[model samples]
Target: MPPATPPSPARRPGYGERRGELVQAAIRVVAAQGIAGLSHRSVAREAGVTHGLVRHHFGTMTSLIAEALDTILPQSLRRNPVSLLLADPGYPEEDLVSWIDEQADLQVFEYEVLLATRHTPELRPLAERLYRGYEDSVRSAFAEHDLPAPADAHVTLILAAIEGLVLHRVTFRRDDGPTITAAFVALREAIRLAVAADGAPST
Candidate 1:
């Protein structure tokens, strides 16, 4: 008889790093397949580990998805409004073009997440939280321009327009960055001017 081979040691790193990788893998899988297609086995396979590894780390599907959302949502926010605001903290009029570019890039990723969320319960809260944080940030950024503030509906509309533009560009057209940014810059400036002149959030 051939000599018995010893079992291989687990290649996974320490808890924190391994967990982070698993979460990231979950994001990729979700992006590619949507929530309906995700499973512990699939994510584990994507991460090059066993299904047991995913279960061991995440415990439940909901918990795992939530953690994944936590990781992804922040980046989504950063990609658009967050990064745009960060680039020009003093709100330089000349930098509006740059802000629009950043925002458009951010929207591409956001729409992907939104598509995934449609089928994943774990992603609902994540989406909600992202919207909340985004709205707050938009309000703050407008406030910085010596504006009163936008109502939730107005903020939602602006966000929707940015996202809708990205989705349309992705689905029906090519990379329309310059055109989209020009439109967004004009709209954002108009909003800022309106808010400033009104001296309060519009209802």
Candidate 2:
């Protein structure tokens, strides 16, 4: 018989769980009560952990807020998992609208954080970075469709249109109607045209 290898070292107890719990708890609080409601005690209570643990782990409320915002991406994906990145060949590029709809709650959570950032000088940089990430994803999806590289303004325009549609629907639409769907189709077509090279077929 081959020589047996030594066993792997045991993992630290509850290390990842504690941090993840606090971050998720923060997200739930923001999602349910808005960013204005987030506090050390609130998140601690949500996570069922000590207030000092939250402070000891994050050191400050802003740091905790940042972590919560950062977590939305992964949390959102898990709930409404995307099958492919825009970089993948044969990916259903048109399905982007549907995908965004599935992640609506996550988007709402992010928008709350963004609104909070305007009043928080320390939070602006991270929020800007987060938005740039959204832009990059948009650019990638555009690239996958063989669309030409859009200018920064064009990227911003597309992102603004899509996010606005989402926000408008979430804020106003209460019934199970295709209001957002109709708007998204028009927005998607507009984006396809915007990314097309001059004189390319608009179809």
Candidate 3:
């Protein structure tokens, strides 16, 4: 008989992979039902695993939430139009709309967590840390472009404007890509104008 085929590699997910799946499931639950609806059972159901598995991976609700935030923070920054624009000044506004459309659920989940912070003081730290991550990315992007980084307040305003646009798009289910692209273009121009005005020689 032909030598037995090498034993099939273990098909089971590793510990870290299972934890990541649970975190993604948690995000989906929060995105669809808000943070109040998130429970180990809900996430386990979404992930096609048992609640016991979720608990084994995350140990506590707060820990799971925090882990979800940690996972999403980097994702948010990477997918954020501001970060994209900073990294590629010539990145098209139309692409911004496309990116938003593609990541609408993730954006919604981020907003849910942010809104939750209003009544859940304990979550404020995580939310603040998330914002700081964005701010830091903005600064780094500015530096990479050989531009002076805007003040923290300016950075905050810029990010807020982008977030507002994203909220509007996702909330309204706006499918008018051109209209959204125009808005993003306007925002991008406004940022450029602000930087230019700041750097201009004194009158």
> Best by TM-score, which number?
3
> Taking the tens digit of each residue's C-alpha lDDT, what string does model 3 give over 31-100?
7998889998999999999999998998887788788878877776675566567555478888887777
Measured against the true structure, the TM-scores of the candidates, in listed sequence, are 0.68, 0.76, 0.90
Best by lDDT: 3
Which digits, one per residue and each the tens of the lDDT, describe model 2 over residues 85-186? 223343444455466666665676788878877788898887887877677766665565565767788778877876786677556647534666566556
Task: List candidate 3 stretches off by more than 4 Å.
Answer: 1-10, 86-89, 201-203
Better of 1 and 3 by lDDT: 3
lDDT of candidate 3? 0.81
Which residue pairs show collisions in model 1?
none
User: What tens digits encode model 1's per-residue C-alpha lDDT throughout 1-203?
Assistant: 99999999878588999999888777667656656657899899899999999999998867876676566556655534523533444344334444434444334435666676777666677778777777777777666555556667677777776566556655554656567666656666655554565564448
Measured over all alpha carbons after superposition, the RMSD of each candidate to the real structure, in angstroms, is 6.8, 6.5, 2.2
* Candidate 2 local lDDT, residue 127: 85
Error of 1 at 149 (Å): 2.9
lDDT of predicted model 1:
0.64
Candidate 1 positional error at 93, Å = 11
* Candidate order by decreasing lDDT: 3, 2, 1
Query: CA lDDT, every prediction?
Result: 0.64, 0.69, 0.81
